[model samples]
Target: MAKPTTEVALISVIVALFLVSTTFASSDAPFIVAHKKVSLNRLKSGAEKVSVSIDLYNQGTVTAYDVSLSDDSWTQDVFDLAGGNTSKSWERIDAGSLVSHSFVLESKVKTMFYGAPAVIKFRIPTKAALQEAYSTPMPPLDILADRPPEKKFEWAKMLLTKYGSLVSVISIVVLFVYLVATPSKSSALKGSKKRR
Candidate 1:
């Protein structure tokens, strides 16, 4: 009795987790998915220059911000560097995943990702930050979008996509099975042959 009830409750909780994620619940239903990317491996100190791209999709509006996207590393003295100097020290500029910088304007109501309205864009100023730090190794990026994490956590994304439908289907299946297995009034169905 209690066992079956507990099992059902557990399933219900799992279904709910599969439905809603950290946020961006339905993010415009198919647009508005933030994708914050970065790079580190092939970054040659002075071999070439600061070059990277950080593009976020699925935006509901458009805005801008003076976000620090490129370098997370900085020394105490680096803070005093002029914006222009900071730009040079960073040596790289690319987009990052931080919605905090997004600014909303009355004129900008909607944008799109691929086809949907993009809410905001993170134009990372890598070179700018590099210049600010000047020769110091840029700190690791802390501006990536807090979403679609590792392989295991990523499964949650797929589950949430068709959550409503999946939940309905699962519920229907469970109900159907219970009805078939549970007798109408007793442990056995009427007119059924008993096992000899």
Candidate 2:
């Protein structure tokens, strides 16, 4: 019985040391800091184009492998990365490293507004470490529209389009009241002949 207890205690100590070493090793995993910016360009046809710029920094001791940016809002057909992307392998991002990428997305003028919500997903070395250092609800980019100046004729046309029917109806009523209130020329002549 004494020999069995000694063996059990030795095994427990070995397991504890292994766990402690593994924890220390994983603590040096890579950490990622991400930032994004969005901008809008108004086309000559009155359509808007969206451009997104992203910057990622690896602020850790180990290299981050397979780093990529992904979002459901990114339309596969219209999305264009600065450099052509053929595979998910982005090489490796070393410690204290900075990487920048830009993408041009499809135009969504009517739907795009100030402080629009967007989520960016990243593939990093360790999800837990990245999440701990990552900040949420990033500042939204402004959508600028270079609208043409409104002309006087355009304002007049808009007013007519909105209130033209009301104006016509009022004009007709005024004409009818004026005709009823005024004495006719023929009646005036008859009255003058009777008085003479």
Which window of 10 residues has the lowest lDDT sum in candidate 2? Answer: 130-139
Could you estimate the TM-score for every candidate? 0.19, 0.43
Candidate lDDT (C-alpha), each? 0.32, 0.57
**Count of steric clashes across candidates, in order:** 33, 0
Query: Can you tell me which runs of candidate 1 are displaced by over 4 Å?
Result: 1-38, 41-154, 184-196
> Which lDDT tens digits does candidate 1 get at residues 3-88?
75466557655644553452246332212233223232211231212223333322322222332333322233212222222111
Q: Model 2 reaches what TM-score against the true structure?
A: 0.43
lDDT of 2 by residue, 52-150 (tens): 665667766687775655433444443434343312224677889987766565443444242322332334544643332221223333344455775
Q: How accurate is candidate 2 locally (lDDT)?
A: 0.57
